[model samples]
Target: MPYALTCTLHLRRQVQLLSILTVFSVIKAGHVTREGEVRWQLFNECSQGMLQTYLGRVNTRGFSDRHCLTEFHVEADFYGAIRLQHAQSRKYLCFNKRQRITLRFNGDSERCYFYERINHSGYSELESAWQPRLFLGFNGRGRFQSPDTYHVKRRCFYWLKFVRYVPEEELHHCEIRKPVDQHVRLEHTNMAHNALRNSLLNQIRATHDGPYKHQDQENRNGTYSL
Candidate 1:
């Protein structure tokens, strides 16, 4: 009976493994359904607790002077989200400190280079420091070949607002405003002034109170010097 139970457990494990393999295969195949087809929950198993994600499609339009634009909106509490949709039927979506998303076509050699960088340097390097230049490779026809320039589009959208935290005693007197460019500069300047004023007040407090008391007495008797 124990042996039979063990065999049943093993069979169940094999079925689970097969299910996982099938999902992985679908992801690697890069298959696309009709235009309106939606694949909800397709990535449920793969994306749970995943820090990054990607989506892409092929570029139907040939290389032209026109530019492609993508917009993203994210709240401040969340790290960030980047979506890269290429004309070449390629799509990449990721979320991280400096998230990156790129799409490339089959037989594209440069895609390998990008994958290496994404793995080694990570998303921060890709968004901030790495400025990937568009390169156009030519075919033997002397024609400007190498799938016209992949119209690349990128945007950084943040929606988190910061609230000034004031002590309970100071809250009544403190004023807060929507931080504008000028307001920020003014606040910084005011902070510096306040710091300097506090430093001067501390110095005065450190001095012996005797001299200050003596001066006050003299002033009361109308004998104090300017």
Candidate 2:
């Protein structure tokens, strides 16, 4: 073989190997997340009872509880961007192409970042590969996010929602696992304890508070009230 032809073949092989390595790297890096194909649950800490209850959009407590409803269904795009669909109303939570977040029953769904923060620094530090700009935060009652909101304060907020990753099909079983507030359960247990205590006291009083016992005591003491 000619020396020049041999050199050309070597260069071609190098380029082909580089191309293959690039494709492999892209796949390993997870450019498109397959995990997003599963369903996600947004459980809010601001809810009344359990933290497992989802941050829903319908019939939720007003600004006092961040207006998060009972449940929502999360759907992800090809790029792993997510949209929260209300379980009952079927409406989607979107940015409204503005600062305020609202439920709009439109085809244009807001691309939300489903991720966690490195620290409790603020909403700005939420880690998502696709959406570093947008965030999900809560201020006890109202949930807020960035870029579309009017208030400068709304840009940064404490987390009010937590994502519960699960398959779309197993959603029904997931709902059953929603936890009850330990404090509330404890309170109920205390109330029952008190009730049982009161009942026992009443029985004791009825058994001992008899007229004959007083007479018996009087005879023993050799004294009479009559």
Prediction-by-prediction clash tally: 19, 5
Clashes (candidate 1): 19
Candidate 2 global lDDT? 0.44
Candidate 1 structure quality by residue, lDDT tens digits, 1-226: 3777667656655653353233222332577322211111110111111111223322222212222212111111122212232211323322222222233333222232221012111111122122343222222221222222323211111011111212234322312244569888999999999999998777666244533445666678889645
lDDT of 2 by residue, 29-131 (tens): 6564323222223333333221222344332233323223444555545653445565434566554445445665663633333443433322212233334
The C-alpha stretches of model 2 lying farther than 4 A from their native spots are 1-68, 110-132, 143-156, 160-226
TM-score quality measure for candidate 1: 0.19
Q: Could you say which candidate leads in TM-score? A: 2
The all-Cα superposition gives candidate 2 an RMSD in Å to the true structure of 15.3
